[model samples]
Target chain A: MGTIGDLGEFALIATLTRRLPQGPAVLLGPGDDAAVIGAPDGRVVATTDVLVEGRHFRRDWSGPYDIGRKAAAQNLADVVAMGARPTALLVGFAAPPATDVEWAERLYDGLAHECRAAGASVAGGDVVAAPEVTLAVTALGDLGGAPPLTRAGARPGDAVAVRGRLGFAAAGLALLAAGRDGPAELTEAHRRPRPPYAAGAEARAAGATALLDVSDGLVQDLGHIAAASGVRVDVESAAVPVPAVLGPDGLRHALTGGEDHAFAGTFPAGAVLPPSWTRIGTVTEGTGVRVDGREPPPGAWDHFPT
Target chain B: MGTIGDLGEFALIATLTRRLPQGPAVLLGPGDDAAVIGAPDGRVVATTDVLVEGRHFRRDWSGPYDIGRKAAAQNLADVVAMGARPTALLVGFAAPPATDVEWAERLYDGLAHECRAAGASVAGGDVVAAPEVTLAVTALGDLGGAPPLTRAGARPGDAVAVRGRLGFAAAGLALLAAGRDGPAELTEAHRRPRPPYAAGAEARAAGATALLDVSDGLVQDLGHIAAASGVRVDVESAAVPVPAVLGPDGLRHALTGGEDHAFAGTFPAGAVLPPSWTRIGTVTEGTGVRVDGREPPPGAWDHFPT
Candidate 1:
């Protein structure tokens, strides 16, 4: 919607979640005051992310529809990062009262498009008046009888691997920030990240020891694994698979850029890597993340940087 | 915190959820990238709400602490209104980088205070930078072996009752807007609502057929019950146990004021009303709501007013 004030809260929500298909996992959907989601596994993995108007995305760079898709994609990626299949999403939207209802409809369409792509549904949500548009998305996932692959599972001799494109979104963001025109694919990738949803399950099934989503660059996210697992990780720059379009800058961007939402994991020394995964590093007996046998500078995107 | 920008996103979250106790139902709490919550009943009741800075609360009028408590309270109240016990809360906070960390800590303190009061814990949350402060809270509740008392279950011959104070918040809001000094309790009630948490479970235990939380005005909320159940509800103003401090004007406030977060329900005709509940109306074989045998006016608060 152009602005949320005009459409009002209830009407916008009604328009947005109207046509979405409800899965069997969702006993109740958006119409009621709350939603009921089934958790047959007796445990549910949940995470929430809030995307703001100017801070998270700008209207000049991305349309309201793209914003909706990006919000759902990032949150769903979090669940996938945990090696869980995303089941449902609950969204909360806040915007001004002077916004158009049509924009909300388009935004919902984009949200549903991404959710369906990931084999999930928008279970329910709430809408409220606000100064600027803010989207809060909570993603729920099913563990599917598999033990959760936490960051603490990695051990020395584990091979580090990654699935999906790295540095694409960050490079695309740089392109957008510099006001330089780029190919439609590059811009589209930056606006809407298509994370590998199936790779998460594959990694877990392939005996992944530790796992995480690369939303805050490779080296930075690896630091999390290092800290949690208390083991050092060494990255082989030559082995890193950089996207064709990124060329030389690809390595640097992949190492330090953020928001790619790619899956990263560590497997046993002799474990056969999944077809979708590319080996990039290995775990060592120590602490922190090292690039090319040296400690890399701490560089990662921080939303609330001091 | 003064401004969130200065505190940084991670630190802000750490400060906010630090004191939160781990509840019996929570297998994990804040700290991990994602939280795992136990769903012992095999089902989880989920609800979400987003509160914007300028639209939902004015910084000038409310401290960061109050805002945090108010945000958590409203969402948890929804779970209680559904005849469930709140188990966990996941929050998403977006704010400017220039904000103070101490203010963010105080806000978290408020959130933790409310969660403790309601016997729940902050499971996890995400913090991001934004142009203004915004909070998105999602509450997960346990049904406690009782079937949900949905709005569609009310039938003719059901007794209508409420289990908490009404109009205090609305009256407080009106007084605040008018700059008329009133009792500190009235003003505080508007800023921070005290919902009847235990009463919800009790209502379900007492065989409440249809139930709703009085987030909106009593007459207006009753209309929703009427429409959902396809039954008419007649409320006797004289029977409403309004606070004596509200006086005659208080009666009008109780009828039309919103945001009390009280539990209202319909029960079988011979069912004994619980000690916490007071009978105020009865269900009839018709549609819509009537006050004192006359059709109630349509001037109640509408979140998405046309």
Candidate 2:
């Protein structure tokens, strides 16, 4: 197996980007100074996220492809949360000089596949040598002339709703941590988050006030909307969809588990939600997030401890 | 004065983004799921560059602010090389958990200031924990309805021209290596590159066929245009400007030094070049780069050695 050092920078880049099909919006693709992507709406939604080795994923637990997919999913979810259709993704990758070229190419494959799922493409990126593997993915989207659905737009009387998986990724993490990897689906969820990308526009069209991707657990992520909008969020435990596989502690995972990439939003109190949206709680005239009229579990995905 | 661990992620983020001014093209800024930037030309030019801590710069040599500025200059130069006007910048910063919060903020300050120099702004980004400090900067630009000026547009018999300093950064590296850092301008050039951002649109308007930023030396970078255009570039040493401060090895430094962020382009045989552009070479029907009819001295700044 050829290491990155053996292939050199340019050849490895060429190999990694070989036959990378450009998406419809990509006016120009890789191997250029910069990529030109069409933004027909006259506006582009941009978001960036960094995934580091060990802190974000374990190499033994997740394949490079899975890591790449997770990296793409997180940023795409952010763009979608802004009520935009993803256009292209720019990646900045860093790894040790000894990294295997095949591993890096597999990671690029994962990034490209995830972009395809979002109707986007891996437009362009930069690769450099560092101490550990790190992927910094920047996602760009077109807003389709719709005003962005920001977290600050949630009103006190809004009804909180969610679409897509909530606690599956966290459950998967639990299994992986305990060295029990039987549930393929659960473990897969941890490896690759499937964000409800389409639900963003649907919720926005349905007059959703505020929208966000549930990355750091449902309740913890909801706290962002609460803090940004100066409103209180009360997530009822019974209303949260905790799958049977999670057992008795499923509620805790659903409430505080992260990396699900589910779509969470607040609609008008009496508004009918789009398909697959489960009503979870209500926005009220207060501050902070609560579960069953009490404080939520203290778990959070902080980059650093307080 | 606190470490990142002491402040936590959210608080540090709030502090970093607080009061950050939005650029003219920003429809939505930081503190949201994604920043909405105006792509008035119906297209956005995007590029990403990663700067690793030890590989790109040593903390003892360059301050955090200088590192930030260097990162911004590199990506912005990429966008400009596409013949686009820079619009916005997104940064993905990864630092150790024990990193000083003040240092991180200063680095951000440097990023914001450099963006301002290019008439752009830091719209949004993400900060995460890592084993080392790394900055992943993504720059976006507007084409103003003009067709992109790619490297492949250069034809045989085109005139090769350059604008901005050629060997100052490399000279600075020499000074730093020899422990003589008195030449403030040269050393500063290495710490923070000042690319001729306006030269991009200027060259396009002047009917330049091909263009690129001299990130990896004049001969090396022009080799990109030569390879892409399937032509040979013969640089005239007499016409090339090598400043005296570069000393006896100025010509070699100008020819092979990297990271000057100078602008290089090819124009029609008799095209009137823009102001400040120095005619340095000619394109011919051949392969590879040459200096006065001889093969140029071989040197390169490769990320990974072959």
lDDT for each residue of candidate 1 in B190-283, tens digit (9 for 90 to 100): 7888887888777877899988888878998888889889999999999887787775578888888778788789999998877889999999
Give the per-residue Cα lDDT of candidate 2 at A293: 96
Using alpha carbons, what is the TM-score of model 2?
A: 0.98
Compute the lDDT of residue A260 as modeled in candidate 1. Answer: 72
Give TM per candidate: 0.96, 0.98
Off by over 4 Å in 1: A1-4, B1-3
* Number of the top-ranking candidate, with TM-score as the measure: 2
lDDT of 2 by residue, A1-306 (tens): 779978888988899898367889999998889999999999899999999999899999999999999999999999999999999999998988789988998899999999999999999998888888999999999988888999998998899999999788989899999999848878899999999788987898789999999887888789999999999999888999988987667888888888989989999988988768999999999999989999986887776553
lDDT of 1 at A192: 85
By DockQ, the best candidate is: 2
- Give a tens-digit lDDT track for model 2, residues B134-172: 899999999999999999999988999999999999889
lDDT of 1 by residue, A1-306 (tens): 354555555556666777567777787777655788887777788899988887778778987778888999998888887788888899887766776777676677778778887878889888887767789999988787677778888999999999988888888888889896576566777888888888788898889998888888889898889988999999998887787787567888888877778888999999998778999989999999989999787668887775
Residue B170 lDDT, candidate 1, scale 0-100: 81
